[model samples]
Target: NAGVTQTPKFRILKIGQSMTLQCTQDMNHNYMYWYRQDPGMGLKLIYYSVGAGITDKGEVPNGYNVSRSTTEDFPLRLELAAPSQTSVYFCASSWRATNEKLFFGSGTQLSVL
Candidate 1:
């Protein structure tokens, strides 16, 4: 089982361009989240899904969208890439919320030019 896998490990987007960062986990976790980590800052939640049909906005959901149509996938969409959005994007999952440990992907390094 591939715990968590993200594609296009690195990307460079021009201003206003759009892209989708793919995320998938094989652990069958019910709690999935997308977070961005900026230099010297802690992880900021972008979007999260409690389950397959429930999604919610998080701390930094301004330029992102998410969908959880299955137990293993939770992809994040960037409608208009901006330089300010440049950061490391991580996809994480947990079997349960309370006191559960999260499993994180290596992350996608995105640069907006």
Candidate 2:
């Protein structure tokens, strides 16, 4: 609901494997964000885009990347999956700024072994 949809709600990845976590919103929001939450930890920002073609790194971007080719799509890419990268990933979108209320996807649970 809320226009945010995340794919592959559950996934298992082998060490050194890679995948792209897809997120999309139909609300036409200009600001989209990617965040990851490790077990027992708060959500950590991974990447965000103010709009299509404008992307930027966030707090924990070292092992991840993202792209926004359209206002409705923002996908996070993990080039090399690792145990340390296993976590619940969330995608959110807002109409304006980060301080505003955001619509978040159900979440993607990823495990690396």
Candidate 3:
């Protein structure tokens, strides 16, 4: 089974362009999250979903949005991309709480100019 998948592994965006980073998991996990990892920095949450139809903003939600419509998919949308938004985006899943270890996708490297 595909544990977790992310599309367009790499992307470069103009100052104000928009893009969506896709994520999917076959584990039927109840919790999913979108996080950004800057060079030498720990991951920072952008958005998260506890289950299908439930979503919430997290630490760095400024330029990102998310939706959870199925047990297997959660996507992150970036609007008006900016240089500050350039970072490695990771989609992760866990069957339980944040205290548990997470299963993460390889990551999408984003660059904004």
Candidate 4:
């Protein structure tokens, strides 16, 4: 969606490599989140930032990192890619945690070999 954008819709990574999943939103939402979904699984929060310069870990944070230097940008970083890390990543933003009017990116599919 235009409101939330995620680059590199699909990716293949070698084990031990690193990459950053870019997510940007034009909605100016205060709360942004990074979620991962494995096959047949619901979205699992990897990280979230309430505002710029403030971030915290979520349900799944191992092998991943995130930073919110600006309200429009929240990038998720995989320091060391692994097989288990391969999944579909979705970036979403909401004015609050109430899930009202939450906007989501198309999603990025990552495969690790």
Candidate 5:
């Protein structure tokens, strides 16, 4: 089974363009997260969902949004993308929040000009 999958491995956008990064997992995990890593920095949580229909803002949520409509799918949306948002976005999933290892997707590299 596919642990986690992210579509559009790479994308380039104009200053104001918008796009969605799709994430899906086959492990039936209840906890999923979105993280962004800028150049020369560690991953920063952007959003997360504990379960279907339950989502919360993370450390850096501005200009980004997410929805969890099913246990296997969590999609992140970028509205009015900006150059500052250029980064490598990762989607991870785990069985539970505590003491569980996360399974991560390859990542989606986004660039805005």
Candidate 6:
């Protein structure tokens, strides 16, 4: 089974364009998260979900949104993309939120100009 999958490995958008980065896992994980990595920075949390119908904002939640309607999918939405939002997006899943290791997707590289 695919542990985690993210579509459109690479995408380029003009300023103000919108897109959704899809993420899915077949591991039945309870915790799902979205993170963005900049050129020289560590992963920054964008949003997360503890379970279906439960989602919370992370360190940087502005310009993004997420929904957890099932244990298998947590999609990140960018309503109006900006150059500042361009980064490598990673989706991760873990059985537990405390100490469990996260299984990450390949990542989606987004560029907004």
**Alpha-carbon RMSD to native, per candidate:** 0.8, 0.9, 0.8, 1.1, 0.8, 0.7
The residue-by-residue lDDT of candidate 6 on 40-96, one tens digit each, is 999999999999999999999999999999899999999989999989999999997
TM-score of each: 0.97, 0.97, 0.97, 0.96, 0.97, 0.97
Off by over 4 Å in 1: none
| Clash-forming residue pairs, model 1 | none
- For residues 1-69, what per-residue lDDT tens digits would candidate 1 score against the true structure? 689999879999999999999999999899999999999999999999899989999988998999999
Q: Candidate 5: what lDDT?
A: 0.94
Q: In candidate 2, what residue range of length 10 has the lowest lDDT sum?
A: 1-10
lDDT of candidate model 3 versus the reference? 0.94
Mind giving the per-residue lDDT tens digits that candidate 5 earns over 1-113?
68999998999999989999999999989999999999899999999999999999999999998989899999999999999999999999999892599999999999999
lDDT of each: 0.94, 0.94, 0.94, 0.94, 0.94, 0.95
Please provide, for model 4 over 1-113, each residue's C-alpha lDDT reduced to its tens digit, 9 standing for 90 to 100.
47999998999999999999999999889999999999999999999999999999999999999999999999999988999999999999999663677788999999999
In model 2, the Cα lDDT at residue 54 comes to 97
- Model 1 has an lDDT value of 0.94
Q: Give the clashing pairs for model 4.
A: none
Please give the lDDT score for candidate 4. 0.94
**What residue runs in model 5 are displaced by over 4 Å at the alpha carbon?**
none
Off by over 4 Å in 4: none
Count of backbone clashes, every candidate in sequence = 0, 0, 0, 0, 0, 0
